[model samples]
Target chain A: MEFSLFNILDLLGTMAFAISGALAAMSRKLDLFGIFIIAFVTSIGGGTLRDVLIGNTPVNWMENTNYVYLIGVVTILTIIFRNKINYLKTSLFLFDTIGLGIFTITGVETGIQNDLDPIISIALGAMTGTFGGVIRDILCNEIPVLFRKEIYATASLTGALIFVLLDELQVNTDITYLVTALTVISIRLLVVKYKISLPFFTLDQKKSPN
Target chain B: MEFSLFNILDLLGTMAFAISGALAAMSRKLDLFGIFIIAFVTSIGGGTLRDVLIGNTPVNWMENTNYVYLIGVVTILTIIFRNKINYLKTSLFLFDTIGLGIFTITGVETGIQNDLDPIISIALGAMTGTFGGVIRDILCNEIPVLFRKEIYATASLTGALIFVLLDELQVNTDITYLVTALTVISIRLLVVKYKISLPFFTLDQKKSPN
Candidate 1:
């Protein structure tokens, strides 16, 4: 609740995710209520999951009305600016990337605060960074891009690992956060730009027929 | 944790849910690992969400290895008896209904134990009973049946509401649970038997185009 650089980035991340959720819902042609629900989940679903896993009671949004108000505002704005926002795809993408970076760090730090294992912390970070979109895609009745084509979770994982390593080495907190967030943002941008993706496995045609 | 009738019913519910999940995954033609993951989530997803929302840390499955083992065994059994299981559609439906009933009670009790309002407890109960399948359907890239059709969530909600009403009157605990579970099971069975479903809503063509 204190105003800080981290808090500011968190708000930005929430706003970005909310807009993306609204856009996705609009594409699905959901009613206003459905769009609101999807946007709400897409913005906070990951953090809510993380907090739940860590046993953080009442979760974050329940404690702070600001997040709820923020998402509501963002959803309304996204709806109003739908066509104009389509022209700003690059800007939206950048915001989403930034959100991914910030959220991953937030998850990792939360895990550390809870004294979880580094491996689990990294998993939490990637999940926190990516699961909102996963939830969004699921509600829209599509395979999550995370499990299919993107290096999204991998990027979050990489940043989380780096953050943990730097933290373990007792690096300056501010520098560690900056480096980790930048690393995630850069990896996502580069991989997406290059269309890089992990190889997908397919069942043998003779063994399994669909 | 106590070796009570409730505990027995809980385990049975877990097993039934796991089998249903494995069956669903198999039908999807997912590989063995995918099937296992699906089964695991399907059995525990709702409860995990419930526990997390209420700030119960480490979640239920983490605190108890029995659920993990039960799901694993159930998944293996389901795979081995997949064809035979298909012949037992009636039995499977019965088990699923039983699971819905028991899990609803468990969720409502947990919420009440945490001193939540009756309305919130009822919501938790319904969510606990139904969200596992919601997650399963989402993972399978389909619209959740809960939203589209079926009296599934409705049955759970009805049972939850009845349970809350009964509890408010300080009814006998054993009788309360039994009545609640039976109410849920009977409602689901009747609904399905008669092909009853909630009416669907569609946006007007003039208002929205796809």
Candidate 2:
């Protein structure tokens, strides 16, 4: 509301996530209504879920129509720019990473404000940063990328841990937020740049049908 | 909590939904943790979402551990009797329909108690009865059956509408709930038995790729 740096970052993140969602929906050949729905959910799903869990009534989007409007604009713009979207991939990825960082910190702060356990706070942070994309993937009928690929949630979790640790140490609030967000952004960028991934195992791999 | 008929029906619905979730997970060959997670979400996902939208915090499962224990037992039993599960399909279907009926009424009631608009209340009712299965299908990487198949949400919505209508007529509360639940259950059963389905269309079918 104050046009603060945090506010700007949050808007940017929301837009980036919306564009990503639009792209996914387009790939699936969803109709206009479906694309808007997907874009809206992908941008706000995590934050809405967090607010609901913490008993924040009406959820964030309902209380403030800015997010809804922003997502609407982004969805339309993405549709118009569909052909040139490939050229904007790098910038989109960067904005999405920034969103991941900021969302994770906000989620953690909300949890701490509610006096939730630190572990729960961390989970909230990671969920807030990642669950939107998870929902989007689910709606598109794909296994959530969170469960199968990327270091996405891990980055958010790491950032959340840093936030909790910094807050515990009574660090300056602005510095804590900056550091936490930077940490998440850096981790995600580096992981993708280097093709790094966590090890995965499937139990069904070794067992034959009974 | 009082072991009333509604309470019993609620528990049966929760258990039925949980088993359905567990069965879906096993079909995907997910690990035990994944199966439990799916089952847990499938049983409580709708009510939790409804509560969150209406600003009910700490959610239902957190308030009552009975639901948790019941789901746990259901999941274990489902796994143990996996090979024999086919024999129980009819029974499972019946319980699931009962759950659909009760959950719809409870959702509508919660919305009305919170002084929501009738339309919103009806939407809440349908969402509460159907979203758990929607979430389940998403987790299993399928388009929500509610969106693509069956008269699932339609039945819930119709039941919710009847509930609102009956309440307006100053019907007794118990009678209202009974009629609403039975209406939903009967509609679902009849729809399934008759192999009736809503017509669906995909936009891609008419338009060629650009």
Candidate 3:
């Protein structure tokens, strides 16, 4: 009952993830089945891992099989509309950012509900936020975006930590979620736009030079 | 202590599955990462799914850490040895067959140990036995090989039934396992050699004949 808003965020997260997945597959010139597989993994992969880690029984997909059917529907439509698709890169990044934000919030909420410590919750949130894309990239045979991109997972971790901090301050749940989502989205969007990546040896170099 | 043999079988299973996955990825003309992805899934996918379904915590690969490392090692070696891999198809098939037999037996045994009924055990066994290749094919963007060729899942089911029946007769566990594995391998290998596949259904054909 406390997680009444979960259903909405869950569906939102899944839909956004699916769109991003399909776009990524398209960029790779994958066929219908390949596109579908990527879409399925991207949409559910992080949450699935999170759920298993948390010992959630029956899994999220089995409890509500409609997610499965929804993915199927989206995949079919993507294939049918393949030739009509344009703006390959930007739209995908946008969808991916949205998914990352939504899933981060939910994952943090779940860990909090489980009464995990603040640090563990933050880790869970980040895992929930980024693992799907990691899995998708790994399956597609690419180094995870986490490893290659600057501030990808780091952005998620930052947002999750902020959320935990705000919750400790007794902030309202809705506001915490909104602010956290914005935090994740803004950080990721900025990183993409400015090509701001994690400092490679920057931290170490500063310390050494000083 | 008695499970020492089970550990050995699992190691063999991993090797077998990895080999099959590598070959399949090569056939699909995947890049190195793609080959590794295929190999990883082929080696661990079914067990992961089963663990998830059965609420096995941490999942095996995530827990062991070694399993993931092993897959990576195999993938790298497979790539470097690609020139020598041409002669490996026969060995790959043999290893795959052995893995299938061992996996089917282990899966059914796990189900039984968990006190699941015969039907659920059969389902789990089949799922555990065949889901790896199914996931592999899907990742490669193909309809699963098992669906089209050699009565693959059917063979797993056949072994599961034999295990249940023999256990009911108070058969020794080792003998039962050996018998079931041999039965499955025989059926699968024979079918492969003979090019035996399930009959195709045509929409124009009448099921009324059944």
Candidate 4:
């Protein structure tokens, strides 16, 4: 039951990320092939990076053709409905948030399975959640929004920590998943709604008069 | 004998890449930690990505402490002699070329070991030769120069094809390496010297008159 639930959420997350990628490509006015490539990379780049770092061979997408089909479907649908997607913006954002939460847990669990330290697990989790968007932004020729003082990676980091802490405390697995996911989703929504952001750090150029 | 020669060349390449990364960081006026992070990522990001894709666990740097020490020493030395290093730009470019050639071979050999197709091996080789710079450019908030029509990845690709073709023709391994490396270096130098470049592809802004 848990396995099926997680699988469904994973597919949904992939679809949402793919759609976002397609939209980015359209905004950039890329060709059809470019749009497909962008969509595919944006959806899988983060998980692929995390898997590679953890030594998970073949990466997740390579092991399954389902991801390819899903991305293709999402890209086509997005292109066809381009004129109407504005009304679905809020829904897309919600799906993306849910994706962030779920992907974070998946990364943390994979790290744990690999016997990594809890801190590293949390880091892997946050990376899994955030790096896809980073890759997406970079491919589109912009600084990653995550690095631009956004609350995005922070929410993933916080939720990852909470997940690790709860697991260490021996909380029920299902309950732990729920709370951790909720924490990430809530933080992201609240931050976006309120325009909350991390403080920017600039290196001061003035030298001390020693 | 061959192993030691390759090892020395690999170290030289690593050092050159690290220095280049530090130079980039210095140009950006990043903080000390930022400098180190950029240098490290720029030197190893490509190989790490390749290893993970091929299911090599622990990665090369993680398994060997020498890579870390090399990067550290290179980073410090580059920082110390930043001004004088400008005079050595030619030598640095030579080292980077050698590194690209060697890294391309390493990636190809790994792919072959894993029973991947020759075409895939060549792709992996090009990726290994080029993705570090891609990651570095992205992290530094610029579109990758490779994407800007530089003759970089093409050189790697051409060398990789030559390497695979020679191997298939039953050429000796050492000869294969030498020839492939020379091809990449020659192409890179010629391209830079003659200002050769691929045609830029831009999306047509206006609809075609029907």
Each candidate's DockQ: 0.14, 0.13, 0.10, 0.12
| Ranking of all predicted structures according to TM-score, beginning with the best and ending with the worst | 3, 2, 1, 4
Interface RMSD of each: 7.8, 7.6, 15.5, 9.1
For model 2, what is the alpha-carbon lDDT of residue A160? 95
Backbone clash numbers for all candidates listed: 0, 0, 2, 0
TM-score for candidate 1, please give it: 0.59
Rank order (by DockQ, best first): 1, 2, 4, 3
* Model 4: how far residue A4 lies from native, Å: 15
Candidate 1: pairs in clash: none
Candidate 1, residue A149: the lDDT equals: 51
Candidate 4 C-alpha lDDT tens digits along B145-208? 4554347777888899999999899898889888988898898889888887653223223331
Candidates in order, TM-scores: namely: 0.59, 0.59, 0.60, 0.58
Docking quality tier of candidate 4? incorrect
- Compare candidates 2 and 3 on DockQ and give the better one: 2
Off by over 4 Å in 1: A1-8, A88-92, A117-119, A147-149, A196-210, B1-48, B56-133, B136-142, B146-210
Candidate of highest DockQ: 1
lDDT of candidate 2 over B102-194, digit per residue (tens) = 889878988898999999999999999988888888778766767654578898999999999998899998999999998998888788777
Name the runs in model 3 displaced over 4 angstroms: A1-3, A202-210, B1-45, B57-87, B93-210
Task: Please provide, for model 3 over A1-210, each residue's C-alpha lDDT reduced to its tens digit, 9 standing for 90 to 100.
Answer: 134777778788888888888767666655444566578779987788788889895457645656767777876675566445555556666777888998998899899999999999999999999988887776665667888664778889999999999999999988999899999999987886788766456343454554
Which docking band does candidate 1 fall into?
incorrect
* lDDT values, one for every candidate: 0.79, 0.79, 0.77, 0.76
Per-residue accuracy of model 1 over A1-210 as CA lDDT, tens digit each: 897776676677788889878777766677564566678778888788888778787777655667878998998888776766533435445656777888898899889988999999999999899888888887877667586554778889999999999999999988989999999999877887778877778976685555
